[model samples]
Target: MAAIALSVSTVKPLGDRVFIKVSESEEKTTGGIFLPDSAKEKPQVGEIVAVGPGKRHDNGTIHTIDVAIGDKVLYSKYAGTDIKLGTEEYVLLSEKDILAIVS
Candidate 1:
């Protein structure tokens, strides 16, 4: 059996979910002080690289997700599932995890 390599140019969530590439924060402070690896704060914002189709209601209606790909967004500090693409790390989260979309 051959292993398949998946190259995702656009990620689409199936339902009320979104895919995000979590941006790593700068390690050095503005004052030029380098924070230790353990002291670095977790990034709360990321760019939306992929989005789910929409949310399904009990009434059989679909509620569309607001965020689109390439949009920047803010999320909870502990939300999302971590994934690795090539050499980069990313996050897979539900639409509810997205707190706000930044301009």
Candidate 2:
């Protein structure tokens, strides 16, 4: 897919969604073996780059999302839409897909 460059100043999520800057996959192992681009495992942890306004409940209230910008989070490995902006990679996924906030 064509990569659309997103800047914090230019992009915003409309609901309980988040935009994450994906941590790079490891290039080399502790055993000193370098993996090819096609062989590396996808990283599930990343820093939240941007977040949406809270999700609105049916009772007419909004519950604030637990995550905020700069929070490092763990997500399901198969979750999120992969996107590339310039040379950097990012993931766009719902707040529910975020499994935990990493310290």
Candidate 3:
């Protein structure tokens, strides 16, 4: 029998954060107005792709994060650490930076 792969590549995050590839929103208005690429609004919500174990507090205790991979989350528009993978952009931020999880 041929073996089948069931898992994908995993990227582990360091410290108390995770890396996420933000999904791009539409660049056109409902009325058929085409907005330039530079005029697109940044999204405040995204899916979690990779996550850190947890963060250590000032008192030395580890505070585990609540968000996990594949979860949709809301965050601040200007928050998170931005990085580039190939031609795409991603964000690395702590779970604390996440505002809420979309049900």
Candidate 4:
């Protein structure tokens, strides 16, 4: 099978979906102990990179997504599909999967 190249600029979500750049996981503990890659947990926080257009309602109205690109947001763990572009990690999630917008 032929492999297709993907870049952050090339990926776009359909409806009410968002693309987020995953934050780097902490490499050290408070006690100054370093963590191995196997010990690091997936970070639940990320910055929004791309967003889909508003979802269409049955009445033909659109409910726009509240979050915008560059907004830091906390999302549900295990939510969304994980995507890797080069060395950066990202996730594609529905707007509903986002828990809160971090200040």
How large an RMSD does model 4 have?
A: 1.0
Candidate 2 — which residues are off by over 4 angstroms?
A: 1-5
lDDT of 2 at 97: 96
Candidate 4's residue-wise lDDT over 1-103, tens digit each?
9999999999998899999999999999999999999999999999999999979999999899999999999999999999999999999999999999999
My TM-score estimates for the predictions, one after another, are 0.85, 0.89, 0.78, 0.95
CA error at residue 67 for candidate 2, angstroms: 1.0
Sorted on lDDT, highest at the top, how do the candidates line up?
A: 4, 2, 1, 3
Most accurate candidate by TM-score:
4
Evaluated with lDDT, which candidate comes out highest? 4
**Off by more than 4 A, model 4:** none
Model 1 RMSD in Å is 1.9
Model 1 Cα lDDT, one tens digit per residue, 6-69:
4456455688998888888878999999999899987888998888879999999999999888
For all candidates in order, the CA lDDT equals 0.85, 0.89, 0.79, 0.97
Q: How do these models rank on TM-score, best leading?
A: 4, 2, 1, 3
**lDDT-superior candidate, 1 or 4:** 4
lDDT by residue for model 3 over 3-97, one digit each (tens)? 74422244578778877778777779999999998889887778888888799889989888888889988888888887766666678887778
**Cα RMSD for candidates in order:** 1.9, 2.8, 6.4, 1.0
Q: Clash totals for all models, in order? A: 2, 0, 0, 0
